[model samples]
Target: MKKQKATIHDIAEKLKITASTVSRALNDNPRISEATKKKVLKIAKQLNYQPNHIASALRSGKSRLIGVIVPTANRNFFSSVIRGIEEIANSLNYKIIISQSYDEFDKEVQTVEALLNARVDGIIASIGKATENFDHFEKIMNKGIPLVLFDRISNELEVSQVVIDDYLGAYQTVDHLIQNGCKRIVHFTSTQRINIYKERKRGYEDALKDHGLTVDPELIVYSNMQLEDGRKKMEEILKKKISFDGVFSASDYAIMGAMQVLKEHGYKIPEQVKLAGFGNEPFTSFTEPAITTVDQKSIPMGKITAETFFELLNSPNTDTVAKKTILKPELIIRDSSK
Candidate 1:
């Protein structure tokens, strides 16, 4: 047996009012009397008549939906950010649709296009690693759709972006290592395609130069930020006959990889070799010696991103506000860097 869906006509019949009057009351039109509006709403609620969002959006020209795109939801950093976004969006009566890029440029483009086609009011994104093209994001600007980028952002785009001070975070980590009697320090990083990696690498270079240490090209290794990659890279470095006493990886996962290899090779942590990583991922502290890393305040970044999007939605002149907000990163000291 099929149940007939309730419509505005059903509510109108129940209230003994014209269908046009019911429609106007549902929309809260100024011409509709306050008493009529209240009566229509009460009946609609009693009838369990859910308003069609698509129809309302078409009529009102505003969809109270926000679109959020990230690389991977499995990461703790992105998960925390999503939570923050949901908290703010819920408070503002806005719904959020989330999409993932899997670090691919084409998938990111498709995700953005789908969100746009759905007529979302705004977009919050973290650029993908393979996103060398900015034209996909340009389409949003062309359509006058507001966008807020966090974490991994396009360096060329002049849109509202929220990000951490990666340079300072990296510099501080390296500085801490130097202060703790580490002269032969090595830096392990992934791709430099994104601004976060570039800034962190720059900080590493700057810190070495500031401490009267020449930047050794051989000590700086760039590979995929993966556990296997980290282990293989450490093996290659060991094969080079280098005796580095310290390592600063760009990500905790990568550090974990290196640490496993170091342990298998019988190297002492913070004694024979001190290690530090970034992102302060949950598992970083659970490791044997634990990990000293940089906390980018990811959850706060997500909350601010949602808040900024709402501000743009409410403001008449969106172009007047600052397009970028940079947050400072904090170093979480632990046994890994002892």
Candidate 2:
């Protein structure tokens, strides 16, 4: 016959104490003396006792786990943010569960529900490009679980958000191009569904207006932030007989797209048409003519998001209030924009 398993009652009986005393000592409650706490922990260890995580979490209503939802973990920006979150979580004795939405709304909703089932203490997310509905996030709010949004966020949602100033970053890029004698400037962006794209577009327009230049709607082009999409859109712009001396793309990938097509067509970069991009992605520096771009402080953004999440957890009173944090993005000048 197998030996009987030792329960908290057994330990309490052995120590000649009540079960409540044993439980309080095991939990290191201040009411319990340090000697009693140490004795209980030592006996529990000797018995190889393991606390039930689910039962304890149910009692305290905290899983001490954070769930992170990103569009794609493959991208450098998202990866850096993950690193930041990991660093903070580990230091705080918490764990992280990550899921990729693949920029799909349905997948994002599913991911959130899965996290909820796991009873995560908090969630950090970057809304997917295809996410127009936020009922899924509403569930988290209704359940009183803390939520933090970074990079891509919903304008309608009331929650703590961490983001860079895309508008200022774009405005400065276009202004720099204008200063470099780029008169016929063309702006390349994505669909206005996301705030980042909309803000960047607004910045580009504002810069042009500041110089007393009227923004020609025809000069503004939209395409998905993909190399092939960039190439195709550039080809369409070329077919329209549009003459542009400068190009500002919302992403580095798009910069490469326009550059590759222009180079094949014998258009000298910085000579015929200068180019500027965003994200300051690694590849931007190695391109034929290094791409000028914006640095969104991706790593720091992640770290801050993690730190902010904990701050919210510690301050329950302020958790319900909306907190907006805007980090400044720096412009990195390179050969692409001369």
Candidate 3:
């Protein structure tokens, strides 16, 4: 009813050679003569022989494949990071599988399981915003799979991580606003309890304290940091008649929303109320008053993430110490904050 697929043994029998010699010839092994390799290839083609990569990987114990997980693949930052990862991986004769979590907790756990089942040699990921319990990630370490995290990471997991210095970025932004005579500044942050936001908030408070500005509860607004969330929070702040000369948001999208609301309220940027945002999204530069922001060095972050993953993957020691790579953030001054 069904035809049998051709194997190395089939080609070997036709050429009167051993199966091992045929296998070596098919693989282009240096031990096989060029004449023998060409004959084996010809016979393989005639017999319709197909090599099973999965079986070969199982035998060798290396898939030469890496899995990469991100919150979303549509963002320029995330896409750029992936590009950097691909450059290094392709050069090393390895390929990558990408998965998006969409910032959901359950989706992240399920994706981790799927990648593991796919038999990826290692995994590189950025934790989702909704993820708090890291049991899934712990499972990876328990199974002895190399896991590398970048950008959005957890302190609870003792895995290798690559991230920019969020605290310094926030501090520089607030200090820049203060230098530009922006007193009574309002800060927009998230209550997600992620290290990035927490670090940014800490930097914001420290800058205010160091500059003789009291941290006012009314000036601090916490939200999801989306564009719509930014507008709603900004509107609520204005409704309370809060006096603020500057606005610094942890997200560029949120700051853009705040800018729209401020414009609608007849407030001129920089002249009336200085504005700044973190994460130098491309849209930040396109705004009427280009927003001052921090560059997270996505390309470098991705390259370093991949490099760290390879380090763990190649290590012979099972109990290798976890490492953390922190990149410096660059403060991009723009018209919005000038």
TM-score of each: 0.89, 0.85, 0.89
**Clash pairs for candidate 2:** none
Query: How many pairs of residues collide in each model?
Result: 0, 0, 0
Residue 315, model 1, lDDT: 79
- Model 3 clash pairs? none
lDDT of each: 0.89, 0.90, 0.91
Candidate 1 residue 282 Cα shift, in angstroms, is 0.7
State the lDDT of candidate 3 residue by residue for 254-323, as single tens digits: 9999999999999998899999999999999999899999999999988989888888998999899989
Candidate 2 lDDT over residue span 144-260, tens digit each: 888999999878999999999999999999999999988778888886889999999999999999999889999998887787877888888888889889999998888889899
* The 10-residue segment with the lowest total lDDT in model 2: 48-57
Worst 10 residues of 1 by lDDT: 315-324
